[model samples]
Target: MEARTKNVLEPLAFLFQLITGILLFVFVIYHLYVTHLAEHDALSYEKVVERLANPSFKVAYFVFLAVVSFHAFNGLRAIILDTDFGARNKRAVDVLCFALFVIATAYGSLLLISF
Candidate 1:
């Protein structure tokens, strides 16, 4: 509630958003290049599976998913905090954001690992 407390958190939020935004940009380009440009042939399920079969590719995919989930959830939190109601419910909103981020990251990790 105190302005000093808010100031301490402000820099953290800004720093995280900045890092995630840069990561998301890099991931998007990687996705585009790998999913499209790298594969000239019509994408087949077999080809996809073959690509995902590599250990390195699997790791990269998981990183992409994790980064994407974090970036998206953080963006949502920022949007929510822009509203008057959200500004008042900071604790609840922060919890909700973390919960969603964890759940989504878990689901994505499972899928990537399974593949």
Candidate 2:
């Protein structure tokens, strides 16, 4: 018996979902610890500004922003795709979802970097 290959788009979307999920998980943990459980003094507004001022921190924040939005929108798309309504409109759905991701990344990066 021969194995079947998936439609290229489905596999790509699945891969993106998996990768972003893992990224979101790791970033979320780090963010929670930093925001909620780290040193008390670091919780100050000025300290937060100082942290965000770091280039590494800015990069991490942008990554977190992009991954979170993608993860959320893609996961939602996956859920909806299981329904009859979604099945009939895959192309439109994919395009809309991609647009959403782009828009989110643009807005989120602005907010993340302008710190």
Candidate 3:
């Protein structure tokens, strides 16, 4: 008996999706707590400016953004892979998902920076 896969990267991709999903969950919890559950006015303009002014905050924001974008598209890719169309067009699915991830991450980063 032998294990078979359409692509060698399938296992790696699954691992990535799993890890990113966990990270996204943690990040979303933090975001929600800060924005909605925190005692202070976390959503106030001044507070937002202060937080964004910190270099570490910016890096954390970028990581959160990237993780979120990757998780979204990777999960989408997984769903697509489950379908006949994606299974038959693995390369096409990969390219499309990667392109979408890059575009979304770049746009989100730009918006964060400009904020």
Candidate 4:
């Protein structure tokens, strides 16, 4: 059962990484387009702020933040595991990464709600 669970979670984690990476890439492209609008005087700073103020956008931003944070931390964890430090303390590093992910997600959600 433990082995089965690990197998399931491993793929799920990889899927999350893949999805979040794609999402971040898309966001970067969209952000660049928005920035381009500034060059044409079509994108005002106030307009950006107002768009973010929309409740739906706020929620989507929060979700994006959470996913990106988790993906980044997981990537770091993977890198650490590829090094000597992780060889000696894999479990500890994993726990730290998980804690960071939770804290980031909670803080992002709080900020979204407050905004």
Candidate 3 residue-wise lDDT, 1-115, digit = tens = 1235545578888889899989988999988887788857888989888888878878888999999889889989999989999878877999999999999999988877886
Model 4 misplaced regions, further than 4 Å: 1-11, 35-45
Alpha carbon lDDT at 103, candidate 4: 93
| Top candidate by lDDT | 3
- Give the per-residue lDDT digits (tens) of candidate 1, residues 1-115: 5788879986888788899889889988988888889878627888888888899988988888888888888889889988998899987888899899999999988887787
Clashes of 4: 0
Model 1 TM: 0.89
Tens digits of per-residue lDDT for model 2, 11-88? 887999899989988998998899878877778899899999999999988888889889888888888889898888
Task: Show model 3 residue runs off by greater than 4 Å.
Answer: 1-7
User: Please, what is the TM-score per model?
Assistant: 0.89, 0.85, 0.86, 0.73
Candidate ordering by TM-score (highest first): 1, 3, 2, 4
Which 10 successive residues of model 2 have the least lDDT summed?
1-10
- What's the distance in Å from true for residue 109, model 3? 1.0
TM-score preference between candidates 1 and 3, better one: 1
C-alpha lDDT (0 to 100) for residue 113 of candidate 3: 87
Model with the higher lDDT, candidate 2 or 4: 2
Tens-digit lDDT string for candidate 4 (1-115): 8568757877887898899999999877766776585457536767767767788878767777887898999898889877999858877988999999999988888877765
